[model samples]
Structures are given as structure tokens and as C-alpha cells.
Target: MISKNVNSLIKVSILSSLSIFSAPLFATEKTIPELVDAVNGTLDTESREAGKKVKLRNHAKGFCTSGVFKPSAKINNALAIPLFNQAEIGVIARFSLGGTNPHASDKGAGRFMSLKIDGNNESLNFVTTNSQVFFASDIDDFFTFQTKVKQGAEGKQWLIDNKPDAKAFFEHIDQMLPSSSFANSAYFGVNSFLFNTYDNQITAGRWIFEPVEEKSTLSQVQLAHLTDDFLKEELLTRIKAKPAMWNVYIKFAEEGDSIDDPTILWPESRQHLLVGEVIINGSRDDEAATLQCEKSIFNPVQLPKGIAPSADPILNARAPAYIESFIRRL
Candidate 1:
């Protein structure tokens, strides 16, 4: 019989390779303000019953951690330049649950991980999720998806009207199982980015953060008994025991791959580069740290030299929404 750990590994691998969920639906053209408003509207509608808390429009609830990013041994690739060329820079990271509910259960369907690398001139920020694929393709589809989700009965009708998008959304949700600890899970950047070398060589790719330790999932019994703040508590305990680490890799897209659409996953055979490692030294669970993390914006669009976002419309729309969220919270 297969061992329990082996069974768990198999389950995770299968979930990672699950088929792409949604196709890119026709999106109506929208300005940045319009898109940001739609996103805030969804968050406001969802949080109506939760009472008055400064709800984060997305990745609303999180715990902060202090760490350092050590670059790879040699800088053979373009992407490695930013982290490796400089001294080991301090990093502030936030691990969060997906959605607007600060009191969301630890067993909720989605999780988020974001990191900001502190630098002298400009900082680099990367935001990733537990799943490799996103539910929508562009700003338009994102607005539609969020609007439908907030509409209740009307949302159900909208999903029925947009059958493929609905199917994809649920399929994506099916794979986002709760993990036993934040350090035990892998995170992915669903959107593609353009990596430019000093020599002007350009390549398209996505980011993946693989935990050094094997991932472990909570049993159904454990999940059912978890506290509302279980994820944060678990991370605190784990850090005290040992530093959590993740190897950073970028999967490069080949000619035919869809760089602009995040809903599609690149093939497993795609080439990947090990650019660096992220080591979490301690948890930033104090009230001051929590406030700093919550108030600071972590937008994927905030890139340093040598790295830029792809033409994915959804990618382009992220900054404005983040800016709007930041201002309103302050």
C-alpha cells in the first residue's frame, strides 16, 4: 500500500495538472477607474454583513513575516540580476487568505502570498496565489466575474449565461485546498511577465515558489476544528521552530504559449530557471507589523529594471485597483 505521505504527494500533483478552467470571454473596454470601482463594489457588497473593519478589497486578511532573499550562486540569466547582483536584501512578506472577510475560516478555498524586496533605488514586488491558473483573463472578464459573484441570484443566472467561465471558476476553486501550514504550501504567479536582459534579450515567463520542505495538507478532521486565525497562528509557531524557505523559479514560455492569458497553464516541459531563495527568519505578528503589512500595497506591476509585465490586460489593471484600495484604507 502507498504510504500516507506518498498519497498526499500524488493528490497535489494531480491537482496541479488539472485542466485549464475558463476561456477568455469577450471583455468590454473599460477605463482604470471603472475597473477599480467594479472591484471595490464587489468587496463592499460582500462585506455588508461582516460589519465595520477596513476590509482589504482582496487578500484582505494576512500576517507579515521578515526575511532575506539570497540570490543564486551565479548570474547566468537575466532574471537573476535583480536579486543576485545586489547584497542580500531584506524582504517583507505577507501570507493571506483570499477574499474580503478578515474573519474568514482557515479552511477557506483560497490563499495568497506576496513579497516585497527592499532595495536602495526601487523595490520589486511579486504577488502569487496557491493555484497556477486565474479565473479570468482580462480586466473586462475580471469585472464580470466579480460582479456575478456579488449578485447572488443574478450572479447564478450570469454564470449560467456564461457557462464556460462559470465552469472554469469552479474548477479553479476545486484545487485550492487548505494546507496544514503556510510554509508547507507552494505559490504561483498566474500572470506572465517579460524578462529583459541588460543586452536587451527578451523572454516571457511566470514565477513559482516551491517550498523546500514537502507540502503537507490537513486532514478533514483537523480542518474542521481549525480556529478562525489558525493559519496565522500556525505560521507563528512554525517560524519559532525553524526558518521557512522557498526556492524561486521562473517558467519560461515557448513560442506558441499564451503569455497574455493567465487562465492557461504552460506545459510541464517548459524550461525553468532557479533565480534565488527566500528565507523567512521570523513572523511579524505584532500590531505594528500587521498594520504596516495591511496598509502597504503589493502590486505585481511594481517591477524594477530588467523585469516588466506582459500585455495581459488583467495585469495592467492591477495597479489602479491596488492604488484605490490603498488610498481608501488610509
Candidate 2:
């Protein structure tokens, strides 16, 4: 028979372990708009500290470049939509640092690329980040994580104490190294989308833009010495010497794949099809062009006829958040 004291201690131990695994008591249900507002609030605070400039609530600082996407002659799959069927399509690509700070250092851990493809009838927008997976699984998790991150050490501790998933994401971000240049970094869509075939069949997949150039990163010392806008300068100079390019591939989901969870990375064995190449020939150096690109909104869900968003809650939340941000910025 166990003693009363032993029973009490055992219960305490069990409760302690449970607390580590469970989400924080502070976690509350948040609507989609509320989630976006929380994120934008944090972003606004950060951007203000960096400089007094009116920028996008997120991904505020970026450089624009003109490119072309040339599709393969034969996709050989029914998932090839009309956009993919086109011989060549014009592209407006934006390379950005992954924060609202317009004056963020070039060596920041997050780097992103957003592409706007001009199709025959409609346009397709693809946004990707250097990391293969997003930090959160859904809007609520995203809000919780972002909120905690804004709180600094105490917030991070809250994540470790309550949100195990978010704790893992923080660890991943800490381990990530900064990319040397936008041209050499591979970008991943991080969200899943549906592809409708001409035959009325549908497949789900994610997009990856693998750079033709070797992926490389600068050393910490080298990164520390670079200018705040070194990424933009490097990209401009590199493309002038030789056009930068990426091989576009789509990774299709299998029966057991997790389409809704952006935090879950698909298996390496998942099959991918080469759809086309994105070639950045020149920079949009003019102020007017840059301003227009900055003002434009890149919607991942703004896909062509054959493409649609998956059941991923995060994907569903993006349109509303983007619209809110657009309206506020305007």
C-alpha cells in the first residue's frame, strides 16, 4: 500500500509533466481577423523601431525584379493547368527579408520570395520562404506563437511551458542559418494547394523553387559586416552579370500525406514533377516600379482555374488577413 505522502508526490509529478505537454492557460480562442491583428500588431511594433517608413505590415522590405517562367513543352500529367500549358509567362518577383522592418539586416534568418505570374486569363501568385515548413500549424497556433515571441524571454518561456509545437518551431528557427544571397537559396511554398486536371481529376501538392546556383550561406562574421540592404544589392549585381534562375517543382501528396499541416514536412520519397524554370533577367530598379510592387498584394490563394487551396486552416485564413492588411495599408 502506498503512503499518503507518496500518493501526493506522484500526483504532483504527473501534473508537472502534463503541464509541460499542454498549451498555456493563457491560450484563448481567436477568430481569423483577431489572429491577423495580433500578428500585424507585433510586426508594426518591430517595423517602427527599425525606421519611420510606411511599409507593409509584413514582409515590408523587399526588392522587385522582372522574370519569365517558361513551362515544359509537355507536362505529361493531367494536373497541368492552363497556366502551366502556356509557352511562357511574365513574372513579377519580389525578394524580401522575412520581417516588417524595412531596415532589417540582410543577414536576418528569414528570407522570402513571392512571384506574381501573368497568365492568359487570370494571374497566379506563389509565395515561398527559405524554410521548408512554417512555424505554426494553424491560425490560432500562429497567433499564440507570434504573441509569445513578441513578449521576449517571458513569451518564449510561455511557449516552452504550454505550446510544445511552438517550442519546437522556435528551436528550428534558432538553428536556421542566414542565406548568402536570394539567388542561391531554395524556397518552399510551405502550404498545400489542389490541382484540378482537365479530366476533372484533382491532386494536392506543394511548390518548391530550387535555385540552379548552388545554395550557400555567409559566415556569421561575414554576415555581420554586410550592409543592411546587402541582399538587394547582391541580387542586383549578380543578375546583371548572369541571369538568376530556379527550377520549379511540385511535390504531390500521397494517400497518407498531411495536406493540412504546414508544420509537417512531407516525406523525401514523395514524387515531384518538374514544371518549368523561372529566369530573373533584370531588376525593377525604378522607384515607381518598386512602389507599385510594394503596394501590390501577393495572394497565395489567387490561383488559376485548375488550382485551388487545400483544407489547410492556415491557407483558408490567409485571404482574409491579406485583405485586411491591404485595406489598412491603402
Candidate 3:
């Protein structure tokens, strides 16, 4: 039989993963400004629920780091993006827990990795998460789910009764253990984007960062012994020994795949193109870097000339909400 501690961890992990719900507000036809208001209002509600002055509206607990992204030799030939054509791009990355509460425990917590790449004349940002799929496909459904979550116990029951995918996600998280270090876990850009080749070949794909190091997870027994702040310290110590790295790839979608809805997972048989490697040589965990991370807005829809946004409503709604969050925090 599973112990009470393990059961508690399972509940925490599932709740943390669903805290932000990985969706947006409003619809594709709705103006983004209206979506922005809805997003801000939800975040404000979350802040009030936290009962504390949180720094970030979501993914509140995290640490910043510095890295470099080396493009593959095949990248420039395939894509027309200026950033990927360069030799090496400077990277500022933040690893975070998926929750509104800044004081949430790290053990069995859901995770996110947001990256900003600096190029010669263009910059690229990737807001990724550990989950392969989101809770909702579009902003309208996501807003409904968010409202359901806010409605208390009865609403949760309604989710279980109506949303089979969400129920399955919760069940999947129950058996999972917390990652030993942030360096080893994989991250996924759940939203889809259109990538254009120099030869005019266009492909719809999502970004995935697979860790160079093998994944390590803590058992419930071991997790119980560690404090809430262990992940950041563990990552800093691990990187100090040697650079942590992840291989970046674009998981291409084929015909009949859902390009706009992130809730649907593309089949594993789909093609995956090797892009490059991200090497983390240093960390910027000081107070100033923390402040900068808080102030900075890592918008997902912001792309270079070679790349274009998909028709995904959640993808389009993200930027305005991010901007509102940035402004409110300031």
C-alpha cells in the first residue's frame, strides 16, 4: 500500500501541474485586448488566492541561468531564421515550478523552462513546460476550465465528470516522482508554429529540448528528507562541475494533426529534426538577474522572419497576457 506521504506528493504534483492550466482566455475571433483583461483578472485572482505578494503571476518560483545555443550545420540550410543561421546565440534561461504560489514546495512539483536567445539582429523566446500536452485546446475552453477550478469542490467534480483527458493527466502524475535536477528533465513547447525553409518549404512543428544527461528522479522516501529549496541549489552545484546541455529539436506535424489545439498530442511516428544544442556554462542567480527575470516578458508569438505563428488561439493569446503580467508586476 502507498504511504500517506506518497499520496500527498501525488496530490501536490497534480495540482501544481494544473495550477496555471497551460491555456489562455477568450477566442480566436475575440480581440487580444479583451483576452488580456481576462488573463489579468485571472492572475489577480490567483495572487489573491496565494495570500502573498508573489513576484511572478505564474511559475512564481524559479532561478535564472546563462547559456549559449549552437546551431546545427544543417539549420541554416533548412530554415531561414537569422538566429539559427548564426554561429552561437547567447541564452538567458529560467527554470520554474508551475504554480502561482512562490512558496510552493519543490518536491514532486510541476516544472517549466523559459528561454530567451539573443542573436545579431533578432531574438527568439521559448516558453516551455515538462508536460507534453495542455489541459485545454483553446482559450475559450481554458477560460471555462479556469472558472471551474475557481468554483470550488463542485467544479472539480464537474471536471472529472466531463474532461477525460484531464482526469487521465492527473492519474499519470500520481505515479510520477520529482526530478532530481532541472538539468536532466526534458521540456516541451506545447504550442505549434510554422517554420519556413529557405527553399520555401513550410512545416508546422513544436520545439522540444531533450536533456543530454539521463533523467534522475527522487523516490518518495528520499523526497521527504529534502527541503523545498533543494532543486535550485542542486542545479547550481551540478552546473558548477560541468556545463549542462540539451539537444534542441523540432517535432514536425504531418497531415491530419491538430496544429492549433495543444491538448492533442501528435503521434511519435512524426518526424523530428535535429536543430542544435543549448550549453549552460554559467548561472545568473543574483538579485539583479532575478529582478530582470521578473520584469522581462518572454512572449511565445514573438518570432523572427523565418518563423510564423500558427492559428492556435492559446499561442496568440499568450503575448498579451504576458505583457499585462509584466506591467502589473512592475
TM-score of 2: 0.83
- lDDT tens readout by residue for model 3, 142-244: 6656666656688767877888755655565666668888898889999999999878898999999999999888888998899988988888788888988
Q: What is the TM-score of each candidate against the true structure?
A: 0.82, 0.83, 0.83
Which model scores highest in lDDT? 2
Per-residue CA lDDT of model 1 for 275-299, tens digit only, reads 7898987644453544467557787
Taking the candidates one at a time, how many backbone clashes does each contain?
1, 0, 0
Candidate 3: C-alpha RMSD to true structure equals: 10.1
Model 2: ten consecutive residues of lowest lDDT? 18-27
Comparing candidate 1 with candidate 2, which one achieves the higher TM-score? 2
Residue 23 CA error for candidate 3 (Å)? 18
Which one is best on TM-score?
A: 2
Worst 10 residues of 1 by lDDT: 17-26
In model 2, where do residues sit more than 4 Å from their true spots?
1-29, 42-56, 76-78, 283-291
